[model samples]
Target: MTLWPGLAADAAAQACPAGWPQWDAFARRHVQADGRVVDFSVPEQQSTSESQSYGMFFALAANDRARFAAIWRWSRDNLGAGSDKLPAWQWGRREGGSFGVIDPNAASDADLWFAYALLEAARLWQMPDYLKAGMALLGQVKAQEVRVMGDLGPMLLPGPVGFEAGRERWRLNPSYLPLPLLRRFAAVDPSGPWTAMVQGAARLATQSAPQGFAPDWVIYDAGKGFQPDSERSVLGSYDAIRVYLWAGVTNDGDPLVAAVRNALAPMTRAVVSYAAPPEKINTVTGAPEGRGPIGFSAALLPWLKATGAADALAAQEALVREKWQTWSRAAHPAGAAGDGEFNYYNSVLSLFGWGWLQGQYRFDAAGQVTPAWACAA
Candidate 1:
């Protein structure tokens, strides 16, 4: 599917600076001579395949064909290897120009994320090799994994760490990670295992916050609903909202849309009222829980855009604009040069929000898109 032309143009414009050459230079700097991303500026202080996957997709969005090709090559040479065949490592620091895995434990979500990223990249770049790699990764997960509590269905955690075997309850991120898996599965086999997984995740998410807003973290035992802990202002919630919005647009008649709509209400208010630099309030009425970087707000834009509620959308837009203005006035660098760890993720979100507001993507009168944001954009 072709991106909405207007949105594509807008995204391309927003991805770069006023001078195209400078933006191209920035893109080049992140990509190493070997084509892997080496920028410390990216979020999480790790060289995640997930981030590279996103970088590839966004590179396409920005119309950086060369960068896209480079990213594809890098991902293939590095991240495409399986666990048994050199198992992907998390980012780690090392001396003498070498890197190591931060933790031996493999995160299931990371693998799934890479798979989804590869699939999307394949579609965007029209490279069958990427698709083949994604399918192979999925096969690996299916061949060796078990049902994790919060994961909806059976999931494969990374190998050699053994964290996946002993855990009775799983941690909650629940938004970005699963959505891509579901989307990828749906694309390949509509009647496949992905639909069930997506529905299960939606159900689990709703159960976690029966009142609508989920906790920052939750524990889930297989066949049991979510066990809530303290709620925090998590960037994951916004990511979940984006996934829900995609589901809503894809299946408007689905009941989960309304459920998601209801859940996001309080989150919207919380960000608008109490969020501060590097932190978001946990409870709508309570003290600030902890520091949340820009990533928290980045997820908010897609949620607002999907909701299409004029008042809420306006509020979200204004809040983000205000935050950007604040950051700019404080002399923070634009596009992932902020003073925090999750800066790149947040920068992407903020840019996406700005692009949406500037009419990068097509939206209805209420500001909701008729299709998936990626598809529409």
Candidate 2:
């Protein structure tokens, strides 16, 4: 699991500039000294592969190699990541009071992020070992999670198992497929199915949103194409929020950027009209359920800025700024986890959307990572 040899101290010495206050606050409050990101809001006090992967990305974005290595280490040592087997999705206190892995199942989104972060870290930090590790993980992803449907060419599954309902039917999560990650994978491994995944991802985003709102999940049949997930129905909520975030951060030079924005234009209009992102929505009718949590506004920042929704972006920005103080207070009243409006998932989202809006990081059309330090240098 130790990918780098004898470079631990050197990595710490090479820590990137500390200029991002938002990231600083996050690392202090969310991530522990051992590099595990805990979701204290959950009763289980769980740590997931998603949390680890996102922490790696944020660390890399901040140019903090030591923290990145620490996060990777904890994930590999605890969750068995950085190996042939996909990382376990959840680790927390169990029923009997022992702390360990709760679910052995893998999450494809976290896997993709792990690979993406590793590969980019190699490029940015000039660590070829990371490139090798990333490539190996990418191979596992292709073998275990990717499948060529009956007529759909190659598509990504939600995980390595349990997603295929039948030979002609499959369950898919639209939010799991981020276009930038697909593009970056294709660039690294031209022969891989990552290219086809880009197109398939576009189809999912557009077709699943029949009414300009992405759903949390969808079903893809042999001939019927994409359909609203029967179990989850057409509800667009937490998972779907990342759809807009991904689309917004995609480089404008990418061919599919315009198409994705156009397909999800209603969200832009809705946010503009309401001056806040809806927490939940019916994808079929484009009907909003209610005003989303403050994090929803934070999540929509990049999309709003990219789409030229100045007034809406400003409104949400103000809301996030105002609410973040309350959230921080509620989350840390006694210097401990609070049972208030504070949410770990929302905090993660805010870090991502708000950090990007603040120019902490950006992705090229090829999905290359560009830390603000790189630009400044």
Candidate 3:
């Protein structure tokens, strides 16, 4: 019942002849000349904190330090708005660079993610200015909108709309989004507001998922606590595991890691039993979602490596190999899938997986040194 067969053997080819070339083509197609990566080639002129963060990391992975630096600079200069301004909005128009959309305003989880991205960029580049900008944005988050959940502790709310009212909506996604920012902040400025917010969000998320499985979504009301609903997303849980792993390794006595470990056990079991080729079981339920291709399989590798579950990592590697082989055989010589706009976004995920498998990571499950290929040299 898996999506593709023989994928594992194909992924084990070690290196694909056209892999890097295909990846480079994908990056060139999506990344605009101005250094900003558009989100999914949408016509409305929108960019994303997640895309920017991944884009920067991939650029660094490819040894394009200048592009990485340029993206970070453009993000800060245009996305940050002004002095003492909050982090960038989730979505905005390229024309005037405003951040007032219903889906991507400043106060949403994406803003915090942008701050986290800057923190990572600063760490990689060792530039004090990026760290300063990250800290400034974190300070704004704490000063303007973080709230306390009775037992859950401090959490961030969505920021203001057009200089007036705040969104005040609490989301589950930010719980994972802010951890990297906190980890980086803790390394430099241990006593800063970002550190506190990180702890608060972890506590709240853990408490909310007492059953060890978080609901797909939740809405946080100012007066009331977290209200659970059925709008669940497998991607959200997958991202949450990454955040918890980061916290567990970076900070001492992290309960979030324990919760995630327990929650993911069933999903891992399902994959072991039934996952064929490129398919992954739903983290919440044991059912197969579909064939994950390269991107999703790649994203899961970090978590698998972080957990030190060798079997899981092996399974994922097999799936990735299948995807690469399939793409290689079917696609034309240019690496384009014949789709103009939807070029290689999915390939970014594959590159990330390949990079990690080749030992490009900040921390491992055992806290050993695993540097990127370029960094290792």
Clashing pairs in 3: 7-322, 11-321, 107-158, 107-159, 216-232
lDDT tens readout by residue for model 1, 76-128: 56554443532354553544546655444444555565566566667766788
Give me the candidate number with maximum lDDT. 2
Candidate 1 Cα errors over 4 Å, as ranges:
1-29, 39-45, 79-89, 95-97, 145-168, 176-181, 190-192, 229-255, 275-292, 309-312, 315-342, 351-377
lDDT of 1 at 198: 64
lDDT of each residue in 263-298, candidate 3, tens digit only: 445444444555532243343443455654455556
Tally clashes: model 3: 5
**lDDT per residue as tens, model 2, 74-158:** 9988998888798999999999999999999999999999999999999999999999989998998998999898666899999
- Whichever of 1 and 2 has more TM-score, that candidate is 2
RMSD in angstroms, all models? 6.5, 6.8, 7.7
Candidate 2 residue runs with Cα over 4 Å from true position = 1-18, 326-335, 338-342
Q: Lowest-lDDT window of 10 residues in candidate 2?
A: 1-10
lDDT comparison, 1 vs 3, better candidate? 3
**Once model 2 is optimally superposed onto the true structure by TM-score, how far is the C-alpha of residue 317 displaced, in angstroms?**
0.9
| Alpha-carbon shift of residue 159 in model 3 (angstroms) | 5.6
How much does candidate 1 score in TM-score?
A: 0.69
TM-score for each of the candidates: 0.69, 0.92, 0.68
